[model samples]
Target: MGKIIISTNVSLDGVVQDPDGQEGFRLGGWFGQFGGKDLEAWAKISLEEAMGTEALLLGRRSDEWFAERWQSRSGEWADRLNSLPKYVVSSNLEQPRWSNSTPLTGDVVNEVSKLKQELDGDIVVYASYQLGRTLIEHDLVDELRLVVFPVVLGAGERLFGETSDKKPLRLVHARTIGDGLAFLTYQPVRDA
Candidate 1:
């Protein structure tokens, strides 16, 4: 079965808001504020993840955001991302702007479960915080790969929100990216 992996970037304070500063958030653009070896290391890791991803799953806004930014880029990473099959979760999205994208209009849980059964590798979710919460609540997410930047954005959208119940995660790996970044890999602990 395909594993649904959430690969995202967040601030030290767990904020996942506009890292690019395009969303008008006061603390936006925390992603590249400090450019150095750490930023390069982060980009390298992100590229590796993209190379390994079998497909991409995103929410409507995230889909739009990525499409607008990546559609014109030309490189190995951009090529891989553009070529991968994309599934956008939206009931009202008439057409997806990204190449090789399909809109999932049915129930979120059911549709994602079906997607999981249909593929055999990593289906990475990038920058889709709302959809990430729903998947976590439904126990549909298999792994979470979080690259945490060094800044702390006290007030912004966080990677996690209130769920119906506590979701326990088992840490599989933890390391430092470059000098200031923390790379964490976690797996959802399922009850036996």
Candidate 2:
């Protein structure tokens, strides 16, 4: 069975919005605000994750967002992302803009559960907060790979959203990347 992993960069305050500043959020572009060795280290880690990801799961807006920015780019990371199987969760998305993309229009939980059984490796979710929340609530997310930057964006969309009940997590890994970034990995604690 495949593992569903929620992988994304976040701020110290848990803000995951407008990391690239393209969304015009006041705190946008936080992802590129830092520099030097720390930035390089973060990039390296992200690249490694992308290279190893078996597939990409995204929401409709996220799919559009990523395609707009990455479709024209060419490099190792870009190539890997572009070629990976992308599953976009949407009820009304007529066509996916990214390459090798498919739209999942049925129940999110059922579709994702099916994906988990079909694939054999990591099905990484990137910057799809709404979908992430649903997967998490359904207990479908196996791991969370979060690279936490040093800044605290006081106001922005957070990595987590409302759920019917609290989802407990177990920290599986934690480490710093260079001087300013922290990589934290967590897994949901399944009830015995």
Candidate 3:
């Protein structure tokens, strides 16, 4: 069975939106605001991890957002991501602009569970805040990889919301990047 990993970039206060200045949130652009070798190192590490991914699981909005940007890029990361199989969880989006994409139009939990059984490699969920929350709520997320930056936006989209139940997570790995960024890997504790 394949594991579903929820990987995200979060602020000090846990906000995950517009860190790259893409969204209209003028308060963002927090990442790389202060230039340093750490930021470059973190980027290299993230890109390396992304390249190892075999498939992508995304929400409709995130799918559209990334498809518009990463699909057009000619870098190694873009090439790998665009070539990998993509499963999008969406009720409204009938088709994705990127190639090798399939819509998860059925029950989210059931569909993902089936996919986990069928796939032979890792399934990564990137930047799908709401979808990540849903996967967490449904106990579908097997692991979480959080890249935390050292800045507070005070307000924006957060990784955890009200509906997120308290679940035990064990820290498996930790790394501090050069730019005051911390990469934390966590795995949910299975019930005994």
Candidate 4:
């Protein structure tokens, strides 16, 4: 089976919203707000990861947002993203604007589980907070790659909100980016 990976940018306090200041959250944009050589290196690594992903999983909001933006862009990364098959988890979105996009049309957990069994490549989920929470609750996430920034936002969307259970994670890899950001990779430990 293919792995379902969540790649998210979070703050020291676990906030994961509007890190780029494009989401209208005035208190956000903490990512490049304090820039350094390390930030550049971190960005490069993130881009590399995104490029390597074969398939993309996104929530309805993220799907619409990225579809509107990335579809119109002209670049190597944009080209790859546009060409990759995108699986969007949505209850309300009937049709997606992007090419090669499909909506998860059944029960969220069951449908995603079936998708996992059918897919043959890496499935990367990016910035889909609600879907991420649901996947985490359902024990569907295989790996979590979190790029933790040093800033601590007092209030915002968090990586882990109200969870159904205490999900145990084992740190498999960790590294500090050039700008003091910590790149942490974790895998969920199977319960005995």
Candidate 5:
């Protein structure tokens, strides 16, 4: 069975919006400030993660964003991303234009639940805040991988929203990915 993993790049204050400045959010592109060894570390980690990912699960906005940027690029990273089976949660996108993409528009939780049981590797969720929150709320996320940056965007959307349930996470690993960056992995502690 594949594990549902939520991988996010967040600010010190938990802001996960607009790391590349594509979104019109005022605090967009906050993560672009890193350079030098930090950039190299980020790239290395991303490549490692991609190698282990079986498929990509994205929200509509992220699906569009990734397709627009990656479709025109060619490299090992881009090749891996373009070739992966991508699934998006969107009611409006009847047929996704992205290559090897599928739309999951009905009963997201149920659909993803089935996906988790059927697949053999990892289903990684990248920058899908709405979808991530829903998964978190329902306790469907098996692992949370956070690349925490140094800066803090006080006004942007956060990783965790207002949830009534108390989700306890056990830190499996923590290390410095680069200067002013921390890579942390947490496994959800489910009630048995």
Candidate 6:
């Protein structure tokens, strides 16, 4: 069975809003402030994660957002992302426009559960706040990978907004990717 993993870019204050400042957030583009070794290391890490994943699990909005932006770019990262199979959690999205994209049917949790059992590798979710909350609340996420930027956005939508359960996570990996970005990996301690 494939593990459901959530990979998110967050701020020091737990804000996961518009990191590129493209979504009209006041604190948008916070991620662009870094360069040099930090940027290189971060990019490499992200690409590595994508390369390791079997498929991309994303919300409808996130899927569309990624498809639009990546379709025009040409590189190792873009190729990996665009070529991967994408499972989008959207009831209304019939006939996904992106390549190798499929809209999940039935309840989100049920569909995800089935996907986990059917797949053989990691099913990675990227930058889907609402979907992340649903997964977290349902105890569906197995590994949580966070690239925490070193900035505190005082006011913004947090990643974990009042979950239904107390999830205890075991730290699996921690590293400073670049200068200010801290890459932290944690596995949720599920009750056996």
Candidate 6 versus truth, CA RMSD in Å, comes to 1.5
Candidate 2, 1-192: lDDT as tens digits: 899999988999889999888888988998888534688887788899999999999999999999999999999999999999999999898799888999999999999999999999999999998898889888999999998988888999888888888899999999999988889999999983
lDDT by residue (52-108, candidate 6, tens digit) is: 999999999888788778888889999999999999998898877667999996799
| Residue lDDT tens for model 5, 1-192 | 989999989999999988888788888877777433687888899998998999999999889888888888889898998999998988778987667999998898998998888888899999899999999998889999999988867888898998877889999999998777899999999973
lDDT of model 3 at position 54: 80
lDDT of 5 at 9: 91
| C-alpha TM-scores of all predictions | 0.97, 0.95, 0.93, 0.93, 0.96, 0.95
Location of the lowest summed lDDT over 10 successive residues in candidate 1:
34-43
- State the RMSD for candidate 2: 1.2
**Global lDDT of each model?**
0.92, 0.91, 0.85, 0.86, 0.88, 0.88
Q: Please, what are the lDDT tens digits per residue for candidate 1 over residues 1-192?
A: 999999999888888999899999988888889435688778788899989899999999999999999999999989999999999999899799888999999999999999999999999999999999999999999999998888877899898999998899999999999888889999999983
Comparing 4 and 5 by lDDT, which wins? 5
How much does each candidate deviate from the true structure in C-alpha RMSD? 1.0, 1.2, 1.6, 1.6, 1.3, 1.5
Candidate 4: residue 188 Cα off by (Å): 0.3
The numbered model that scores best in lDDT is: 1
Top candidate by TM-score:
1
Report backbone clashes per prediction: 0, 1, 2, 2, 0, 4
What is candidate 6's CA lDDT for residue 146? 93
Candidate 3 has its poorest 10 consecutive residues by lDDT at 30-39
Candidate 4 lDDT, 1-192, residue by residue in tens: 778999988888989888778889978778788545677798688679878887889898888778778888877777888898989988777897777899987788998898889987779998898899999999999999998888878899998878876899999999988848899999998782
Sliding window of 10 residues with minimal summed lDDT for model 2: 34-43
Off by over 4 Å in 2: none
lDDT of 4 at 83: 92
Off by over 4 Å in 4: none
